[model samples]
Target: MSVTRITDVSEPLVAAFANLVPQLSSSATPPTRDEIADFLAQDGVYLFTYSNDDGAILGMLTLATFVIPTGKRAWIEDVVVDEAARGHGAGAALVEAACEYAHEIGAKTIDLTSRPSREAANRLYRRCGFVARETNVYRYGG
Candidate 1:
């Protein structure tokens, strides 16, 4: 399969997430078709899928780009490959597509995070040229 940048929502895309998102998180629910459409309407947001010739989506990732006083920035989020598809370069392809798109949009740098428990993902990140930063990442949720 190959990476495809998605601008609109479809039943297949929604179904793809139904299968893919749960593989990434036990508590997370997949995005609805409307939600996907609304998200794509926002500026500098991208959703990419890796699908085969027969139209099976095997992987997906989201890229968010924005500008601040410093410069353009991009973040890759929710990267996941089918459990059966891992180790076959699908994740790397998704990441590479994100980086290429972010660069085309003028992002100075791209960033993503993976839990240490996700050893395979961390290794994939390193293989894709992402460096680990020696800094704290804090999050607050209400």
Candidate 2:
């Protein structure tokens, strides 16, 4: 029912990630408890979870923030809502939370990338105030 940043790792969070990772990326494996703990411990890396009133986690997202010569920057990554919970506004809530955090952290801009084939998600991002940009996003390797 609400979005909150995760500061500690727990079995419920571990299990939720196990269920959500594949939904985010078929080729990516879910992180273990220790891995999640390590990630949470990293500076400027944040993990937020959206859970129902009964404490059932329904969606999650990562917000990474950093400072450089230009200014503060944030990236919203790996946003995914549970398949059954898609239409109930969890994705929008998660995104709004991240954007608020980005503003709090003084980030001038927040960025995210979605595959063109994910039409619904792309539309959601646009509706959430992200503008499409013409730029090449190059990965270091395949």
Which one is best on lDDT?
2
Looking at model 1, the pairs that clash are: none
Cα lDDT listed for each candidate: 0.92, 0.95
Q: What are the runs in model 1 whose C-alpha is more than 4 Å off? A: none
Deviation from native of the Cα of residue 86 in model 2, angstroms: 0.4
Clashes of 1: 0
Question: What TM-score would each prediction reach against the true structure?
Answer: 0.96, 0.97
Clashes of 2: 2
RMSD to the true structure for each prediction, in A, is 0.9, 0.7
Off by over 4 Å in 2: none
What is the alpha-carbon lDDT of model 1 when measured against the actual structure?
0.92
